[model samples]
Target: MPHLEEHVSLRPYNTFGLAVQARYFARFTSAEVLRQLLALPEV
Candidate 1:
């Protein structure tokens, strides 16, 4: 499995207009699917 850094932040790259750190992250297209996926044990 792959892992990401916990506390790194970047200012100029994220379109969300905030510097953030993600131990785990993903993008979702549907609200229902996102909720279901988040409820999964593997997530």
Candidate 2:
């Protein structure tokens, strides 16, 4: 599996000073949306 860092960076955009950011980030209002995102190949 590809490492998350390979696709994302936290050096500039991260406000919390975390070591990394999600290569792909999303917010879901419901379970169905979460499932859909999880099913995407790019994710």
Candidate 3:
């Protein structure tokens, strides 16, 4: 991952097209990093 914190937000999403931030949030450049990101407590 270039940066794990990229695109993360505490602000209310300005759209109703999605469910929630954490519900669809993810950041990783590879499967290995994806596994690590999915394990995060905040994921």
**Candidate topping lDDT:** 2
Cα lDDT tens digits, model 2, 3-36, are 2223566656767777775667565777777777
Q: Give all TM-scores, in the order shown.
A: 0.39, 0.49, 0.39
Over 4 Å off, model 1: 1-20
Global fold similarity of model 2 (TM-score): 0.49
Model 1 lDDT per residue over 1-43, tens place: 2222344555555887697665555556777767866786656
Candidate 3 lDDT tens digits, 1-43: 4345644553565564553444345546788888877777665
1 or 3: which has the higher lDDT? 3
Residue pairs of candidate 1 with colliding backbone atoms:
none
**C-alpha lDDT values of all predictions:** 0.58, 0.62, 0.59
Candidate 1 to truth, TM? 0.39
Q: What lDDT does candidate 2 reach at residue 1?
A: 25
**Which ten residues in a row are the worst by lDDT in model 3?**
1-10
All-Cα superposition RMSD per candidate: 5.6, 6.6, 5.6
Query: Distance from true position, residue 38, model 1, in Å?
Result: 2.2
